[model samples]
Target: METLIKKNQAEKQLGLGILIVVIGSVFLLRNSGIDIPRWILSWHTIMLGAGLWIGYRRNFQGGGWLALTIIGAIFTLKHIVVFDFELSRITTALVLIALGLYVILKPKKVTTFKNYGQANQSDFKDLNS
Candidate 1:
């Protein structure tokens, strides 16, 4: 348990450090008259960063971060590349697929009910017999 906690802490710290470096680099480049793309500084990019940070912090166990990351990437791509079809439709389809995959592939929890004050599995088995 201690090792797991330490690992999570380390991941969080590393994520924070990377975020700081990226933000600083963006600012430095902008200040140096490097024509940075508008999309790179937009809210979509922020969403992407936030999603990545959340995923890293949580060790990519859940779907919230994945959803955010997908949305951000799709929107960012929209800005960079032109698409003939509707972006909303594509986004919705992709999000649904991701959610379905997560639901189907995520680990299932094993629940064991202990008999402290109530009847146990053995009681049910005897009743059946």
Candidate 2:
């Protein structure tokens, strides 16, 4: 268990280090007048990067990163594709659907009350005494 925890910590640190380096490199290149694509510097790309970083930090077990990634992807796609219908409405619907699915499918945590009855009985006995 101790070794596993150390390994996970190391992995998380490595991920953060790599992310920082990549972000720094991008900024450096931009400042040097290297013409990077506009899309790569867009808000959607930032959202995607944030999602990936969060996912890496959490070992991808949590859904928060998934939500950010999906939202970013949807917006990015909207920019890339010329759809006839309203994409905002579709995005809202998709968000609702995903939320519903997550609520229904998420794992339930089981909580156990240990020695509750015995504790209550002891308390009653003490009160009477």
The root-mean-square deviation over C-alpha atoms between each candidate and the true structure, in angstroms, is 5.9, 5.7
Task: State every prediction's TM-score relative to the real structure.
Answer: 0.58, 0.51
lDDT of 2 by residue, 23-49 (tens): 789889989999765666689978977
* Regions of candidate 1 where Cα sits further than 4 Å from its true position: 81-129
Model 1, span 1-129: residue lDDT tens:
999999978977887898789889988999999988788889998998789878866778787898788879788766663445645546667667877887888778867766655654245776687
In model 1, the worst 10-residue window by lDDT is 80-89
lDDT of each: 0.78, 0.75
lDDT for model 2, please: 0.75
TM-score of model 1 vs. true structure: 0.58
